[model samples]
Target chain A: MDDPLMLARVQFALTAGTHFLFVALTLGLATLVALTQTRATLSGSAVAERMTRFWGQLYVINYAVGIVTGLVMEFQFGLNWSGMSRVVGEVIGAPLAMETVVAFFVESTFLGLWIFGWDRLNRWVHLGLIWVVAATAYFSAYFILVANGFLQRPVGFTMVDGQARLTDLGALLTNPTALLAFGHVVFGGLLTAGFFMAAVSGYHLFRRTAEADLFRRSMRTGLVAVVVSVMPVAAFGGMQYAYIQPTKHPGAQESAAQVAQFEARFGPGDYTPPGLATAGEVLMEVAWSLMFFLAFAMLVKLPFGRWLERGRVFHVLMMAALPLPYVAMISGWVFREVGRQPWMVYGVLKTEDALSDVGAGAVAVSFTVFTVLFAALVVVNVWLLARFARRGPEAVRLGAPGAPEPERPALTPTF
Target chain B: MQTLALVVLAVLTAGYLVLAGADIGMGMLLPVLGRDGRERRLVIAAFAPFFLANEVWLVAVAGVVAGAFPGLEHALLSGLFPVFVALVAGWVVRDAGLWLRGRVDAAAWRAVCDGAIVAGSWALALSWGAVLGTVLVGGSRVEDGVNAGTVLGLPLALVFAAHGAGFARWRLASGLAERARRVPGRYWVSGAALAALPVAAGARLPWSQVVSSPEALAVTAVMCVLMVPLLAAAQALVWWTFRGRAESPGYL
Candidate 1:
C-alpha cells in the first residue's frame, strides 16, 4: 500500500474497473438493439424499429459517458503508469495505436452518421453505420484484450537488458487466453443489456402505457438474447478463464511448500502452518462457481419466463443476478492480472521494474474523487434513463382513445 | 527473427499511416476543403464525430512499439520527446476545437480553433515522418536487437513534411488535390533514402521471415508498388464520395 506502484495499480484498477461496467452494458445492449431493429424493419414491423430506437437511444447516451471515461483512461498511462509505457511501449503501443486508427475511427465515424444521419439518409444505410459502430466497439475491446492477454502469459518474447522485446507477434495475436477473455467479456455485455431491456419492457407492461405487442416483443427479444448469450460463458467461460489464471489454483501448493520449509526449521509440534493463500483461492473459486450456478438457473427459467409475466419473475431475478457477473468479471480481471503477479509484462520486466515513484496519498485522493464522480454518473445515467423510459415510445406518439391528447396537431417532425 | 519482426512493425506502422494519417489529414484540411463558413462547419461535422476514436490508432501503434520493441520505444520516445508532447497536446487542443463548437459564436474563436487543430495535425503528421526518417536513415550499434536510425535536422524535417502532405492528399482528396500533387516524388525519394539507410544488423518486418523470406519479398515489393496507384485512386474516390455541395445526415 505504501509503494507508489502499488497505489497506482489500485488507483487505476478502481477507476478503470468502475467505469468498465457501463462500457460492457453499452456494448451488449447496442448490439441487441441493432439486431431487434433490423428484424423489425425486415418484417415491416414499426414496433420492432421503435423498440430498437428506444433501447438504442438509452444505450447511446450511456455509451457517450463511457467514451469519456475511456478517454480519461488514456491519460492515466501518461500520468500514473508512465513507467510501464516506457518499458513495453513498443509492443503494446501498436494495438492501442491501431485501436485508435482502425477501430475507434470506424466506430465514431459511423456512429455519428448513425445518430445524426437518422432519417436524413437512407434508413438501411443508417442501420449499416450502426453495424459499423458496434463492430468497431468490439474491435477496440479486442485490441485491449490481446494486450492484457500478453501481460497474463507473455509468449513469443525475450528479455534484453531488463526490458521485454516482442520477438513473436504471432504468439501475441493467437494467445488462447485473449480469445477466451474477449468472448467472456462480450457475452457479459450482452447479458447486462438483456436484463436492462427486459426490465424496461416489463415496466411498460405493468403500466399499460404502450402497445402490448411492442412491449411483449421487446421482452421476448431481451429474454432470448440473455438466455443464449449468457449460457456459454456461465457453463464454459468460467472453466476456460480458471485455466488461464493458474495462480488461482497453485496458491495452495505454494503455501504448503512454505509451511513444509518452516516445519523443517522447527519441530512439527512447535509450529503451525498458516494456510491463508489456499483460503483465498478457494474463496475465489466458490464465488465464481456460485455465479455460474445462478446464471444457469435464470437461463433455465427462460422457456417458462413468459409464463411468469404476471409476477415479472424473470426481470426481477435477472437484475438480481447482474452483480454476480460483475463480481466474477472483477475477480477474473484481478485473478488474471494479479495472478500473474510480480511481472508487469511476463518474464520481460517485473512489475517492480516499471513502477513510478508516486506517493499513496495521491492515489487514494484521486481514487476517492473519481469514485464519487463515477457514482454520480451512475445515478444520473440511471435516473435519466428511467425518466425517459417511463415515457414509452407510444406515450410520446399517439395516446389512448380515452386518455388526454396533445394540444398541438400530431405531426412527425421533418428532419 | 529480429529482422522479421521489424518488418511486421514496418507494416503495422504503414497501416497506422494509412488509417490515422487519413484521419489527421481530414481534420487539418477542413479549412482547405470548405469554401465558406457553412461548408467548413459541415466539414468539421463530418470528421468531428469520429476524432477521438480515430485517434485510437495512435494509441495502438504506441502500445505495439512500446511492447514489442522496448529498446526502440525507449530511444525513440526520448529522441522524439518534443514531438510526442506536441502530438498529445495537439490531440487535446483539436478536441477542444470540436467540443467548443456550441459555445462560441465569435468568428475569431472559430478561426482560432480551426487554426490550432490544423496546425496540430500538421505537427503530428510531421512527427511520424521524422520517426520514419530516423528508422530509415540511422541504426543503433547494438549486438542482438532491432536498431533505430538517426533523425537528422534537415532531411528528417523535410521528409516529415512530405509524409504530412501525402497523408493530407489522401485524406482531403475531394477538394485539396492539386495543392499536394507534387508529394509522390518526395515520398518516393524519402522511401528510397529510408530503404538505403545502413544497419549494423538486418531487421525483419512482421510477415517477411515466414512467407516473404525471399520468394515472399515479391508480395511486399508489389504491395509497395500498388501503394502509389492506390494512393492516386484514393483521391478519385474522395471526390466521388464527397463532390456534392454537401449531404447533411441527421445524427452523428
Candidate 2:
C-alpha cells in the first residue's frame, strides 16, 4: 500500500520512456513526409513521390507501436494516481479532455485517410490531410506535456480543505514550462525522424539500389530538419532548466539551508547526490549543442557541397548524430525529474509519501519483465527495420524512368 | 462544496464517455455499417482488433475509485450494481457478439452480432448518462439512501446520449457524419436543453460556494462558462473541417 506511489512512478517512467521512442520519431517523420511530398508534387520528382511512400510507411509502423504503448500511461494515471486526481482533476482534466476531443481525433481522422488514401483523394488535399495529421500529433504531445509540466511545477491551483483545487484556467494554460517543454520535445522528434530517414537511405546506399540522388536528398531532408529544429529545442532546454532550479515547496531546498541535513542523512559518504548534482544536465546541454552542429554537417551529404563525401564516414556521422539527440533528450529529462527529487507533484505531495504496498521482490520481477520486453522490442524493431530497409524505395523504383529498375531480392523469388 | 465537486465530477465523467465511448461504440458497430455484406464483414473483421486496449480506461477509473475513494467506490459500484450489470452486460455482450459474429459468419449470426452491438451501445450510453442524471437530479426516491434513477430526462442524461450519438456519427464515416448532421431536431434540441440545465442550476447556487472561496469559485465558473462556447467551437471546427466535398474522404 505504501509502495503504490513508488510502483506507479517506476512503471510510468518506464512506459513513458519507452513510448517516447515511437512518438519522437512519429512527429519528426510524419511532418517531414508531408512537407517532402508536397515538394514532390510541385517539383515533379518521381524519387520524391516514392520518398513520401517510403517515409509514410515508416511513420505508420512507428505510430502503430506508439498507439499501444501510449495507452498504458493514460490508464496508469487513473489506476495509480487516483489520489492526485480527486484533488486537481478539474484543471488537470482539461488538457486530457482536449487531447481526446480535439488532438487525438483529429490525428486519427487524417491518419486513417493518409494511410488508406494511397490512390484515393486529390493529391494536394491528401497532402493537406497528412499535414493536419502531423500537426495534430505534435498538438497531442503538447497538451500531455503541459499536464506533465504542471505536475512537475504545479500552478494555478489553490488549497482548500487541505487539498489543492484549480483556481486559474489561464494560469494552467500558460504554465511557464509549457512552451519550453514543447520546444525541446518537438525538436527531439525531428532528430528521431531524421535518424530513421538517414538509416533507411543509408541502407539503400549500401545495397547499391538507385543511389546518389535519392539517398543524398533524404540525407539533406533528414539533416536540415534536425538542424532547423535545434533552435527551439536549445532554447526550451534552457528554460526548463531555469524553471526547475528553485524550490518553493516547503523546505524542499534542503541543500540551501541545511548542509547538516545532507550531512546528517547522507552524511558520511553522502557527497554524491549533491556535489555533481547538475553534472548530467551540464553534459546534456553540451551534447545537444554538439549534435546541432553534427546535424548541420549531415546536410552536406549532398554531392560536392561536402559535409562529407557520400560514403561510410557520412553514414556513420549521421547515425552517430542520430543517437545524440536521443541521449541528450533522455539525459535532460532525467536531470529534470531527478533534480525535482523529493517532490512528486511539487508543493503538494512528497515522493516518499507515495510508495505502493508492493515489496522489493515484486518490483524487481516487474522491472525485469518490463526491461526484457522493451529490449525485445528494440531488437525486433532493428531486425524488422533492417529487412524493410533492404526493400528500400526499390519496389516503387521498378517503374521509375532512367533508373536501372531494382531487382527483387533473391531470397523471396516467386517460386 | 461536496455537491459542487460531485457535479463537476459528474460532468467530467459524462464527457469521458461521450467522447471516448463513441470510439468504443463505433468499433462495435463496425461490422454493421459495412457497405454490402462483404465490406461490412471486412469492416467488422478488423473491428475492435485491440479492444482490450481501448477499454483500459474504464478499468482505470474503477481502480481510481477503489484506490482513491474507497468510500465512494462501495457506495457507488455496489449500490449501482444493477446499472453496473447493464453496463457490463452491454460491454460483454457487444464484445462477445463481435467475436461470435466473426466465427459464425452466417448472415443471421452477423445480424445478431450487429444488433447486440447497437443495443449494447445504447445501453452503455444510457447507463453512463443515467449515472450522470442521478447525480444531477438526485436520483428517483433514494432507496437505501442511494440515488437510483430510471434514467429518462433526469437532468443531463438524454443530452449526454445525444452528444454520444453525435460523436458516434462523426467517428464512423463521412456518411454517418452527414446522417448525424441530419438527425432530428429533437436530438439536438434535447442536447441543447440538457446542456443548459447545469448553467441554470449553477446560476441559482446560493453563491455560497462562490462567496466562500471567490477564487476557486471564479475558476469553476470560468471552466463552466468556457464549456459552452468551447463545445460550440469544437462542433463548429468539426463541421468546418469536413463541410465541403461530401463524396471525397474529407479528413478535415
Candidate 3:
C-alpha cells in the first residue's frame, strides 16, 4: 500500500473507474436525447417533447461534471506516467491530440449550441445540433480507443532514435483491436443509457407521477434502446475476448516461444500478461450473462404491457437492475486493463518502466486528494440529478413547446 | 512551409491563452468584482455559452505538441508535472463550482462553490503562467526526479490577471468594467518586471539552441514579438464593438 507504483496504479484505477461511470451514462444518454428530440421534431408530439427536455436535463448535468474527469485523466499521464509519454508520445499523442481538435471541439461546441439553442433556433436546426453532439461523442471515443488499441496491439509505428513514431496513420485507424473495443464501448454506452432511462421511467410509472404520458413514452424508448443495444454489446465483447484469448492465455509452447523471441529482442523478462486467468474476467462474464437475462425478461414482457404495467414488483426489479450494466462495464474494463498487467504498451514497454520517478508521498497525497474529490463529485452529481428527475419535465426551464412565446427571440439565425 | 505545423501550434497556444485567460480571469476576480450571488451568476452567465468550447484550443495545443513535437511535450509536460497536476485539480474544482452554483439553492452551497471558483481560478492562472515562465527562462531542471524551475511563478499569474482584466474591460460593463480596466495598469508594470527576471537569468541560452530548427525558431520569435501588440489591438477592437452595457441580463 505504501509503494509508489502500487499507489500510482490505485490512483489511476480509482480516478479512471469513477470517470468511466459518468462517461458510460453520458455516451449512452446523449444518443437517446438526440433520438428523442428527433422523434419530437418529426411527430410534433407533446409527450415526446417532454421526454426530450426531461432526459436532456439529466444529460447536461452528467456532461458538465463528466467533462472535467477527462482533463484529469490527461494530467495523470504527465504526472504519474511521464516515462510512457517520453517514449511513446509521438505514436499515442497524435490520436489523443487529434481527438481534442476534431472530436472534443465538435462535441463541446455543438453541445453548447444545442443547449442554448432550445428556444432560439428552428426546430430542425436544434435537432441537428444534438445529432452532431452524438456523432462527435462517438468520434471522440474512436480516437481514445485508437490510443488504447495501440496499447492492446501496437501497430503503425516504427522505433526512431529510441522513440516510437507514427509511420502509417491508415494502419493505426484500421487496427482490429481498436475497432472491436470501439464497438464494445459504444454499445455498452447505449445499454447504460437504456437501463438508466428505464429505471427512472419505471420509478415514475410505478408511483403514478404527474407526467404519466412522459414516463410511459420514455419507458418504451428506454426498453427499445436496451433490446437493440444488448445484442451488439454482447457480440462485440465476445469478439474482443476471442481476439485477446490466444495472446493473453497462450499455450505452454506458445508462452515459451514468445519469451524466447522477446528475450532476444527486448532483452529479458516475462512476456505473458500476468495472471492469465483472473476473477475480473469471470465476473465480467457473469455480469454480461445477468444483463442478457434481464434484457430478455424485459423483452419477453414487452408484449403484455397491461400485465407488466400493473406489476409493481417487476417495476421494482427493473429499478434494482439499473446498476447491472455499470457492473458489467467496470468488470469488463478491469479485466481488459488488468489482463494487460506489467505492460503499459503490451510487449513494447513495461508498466514499471513507464512510471515517473516522483516520491511515494507525493503520489499518495494526490491519490487521496483525487479519491476524495471524485467521491464528492459523484455524490453531488447524483443528488442534483435525483432532485431534477423527481421534479419532472416542468422543472426544465428551456421552455416547453406549447408555452406562450416571448415577444422577441434573442438568438440570431446563424444558417 | 516545413515549419507550418510548429507555427500552427504557437498560434493555437496563443489563442487558448488569450481567450481562456479572459474566462479564467473572471473567475479569479469573482470575489472582488461580484458583490453578491446575483452579480456572480450574472457574470458567469455572460461567458457560459462559449467558455467550454474555448478549451478546445488547449486540447489542440496539446495535440500539436504530442503529435508534431513529442520530444518537446515529453520535456515540457513531464518537467512541469506539479504545476500541471495543480492546474487539473483547479479545473475540476472550477468546473464543479460553476456547474453546481445554479443547480442548488442553498446559500451555503453557493458560497462554497464561489470560494472554489476563486481558488481554482488562482491555481489555474498561476500554474499556466509558471509553465510559460519556466519555458522562457530555460531554468527548468529535473531535481529529485521531479520538475523544478527557477521561473518566478507570480509574474505569469500577474500577467494572466492583466490579460483577464483586458478581457473584462471588453466584455463587462458598468462599475465592473471600470474596475477591470484599472487592473492591467496596476499589475502590468510589476508583471513585466518579474518576467524580465527570467530573460535576464536565461540570457545565455540561445533561442537557436533551444529550438532545433532555425526556421521554426524564426517563426516562433516573430509570433512572440507580434503577440502583445496583437492582443492589445484585439482587446481594443472588442471593447469598441461592445462599448455599452449588455442588453440582456444573462443566457435565456
Pick the winner on TM-score between candidates 2 and 3. Answer: 3
**What does candidate 2's lDDT look like per residue over A227-301, in tens digits?**
677777777776775676453222355444443444465434222233223666777888887876776665444
Q: lDDT tens digits, residues A91-151, model 3?
A: 7876776677667766876777676546656789789889988998999999999989998
lDDT score of residue A7 within candidate 1: 69
* C-alpha DockQ for predicted model 2: 0.06
DockQ ranking, high to low: 3, 1, 2
Ranking by TM-score: 3, 2, 1
What's the distance in Å from true for residue A295, model 3? Answer: 1.7
The whole-model lDDT of each prediction reads 0.55, 0.54, 0.71
TM-score of 1: 0.62
- Candidate with better DockQ, 1 vs 3: 3
Q: What share of the true interface contacts does each candidate keep?
A: 0.26, 0.02, 0.41
Residue-level lDDT tens digits of model 1 in B85-187? 4454455445545544322345675677677667766666555555454544443322121224424433544544454455444433244444445445244
Q: Model 2: how far is A42 from its true place, Å?
A: 3.2
* Worst ten in a row by lDDT for model 2 chain B: B243-252
After superposition, candidate 3 runs with Cα above 4 Å error: A245-247, A250-277, A304-309, A397-415, B139-151, B169-252
Candidate 3 local distance difference test against the native:
0.71
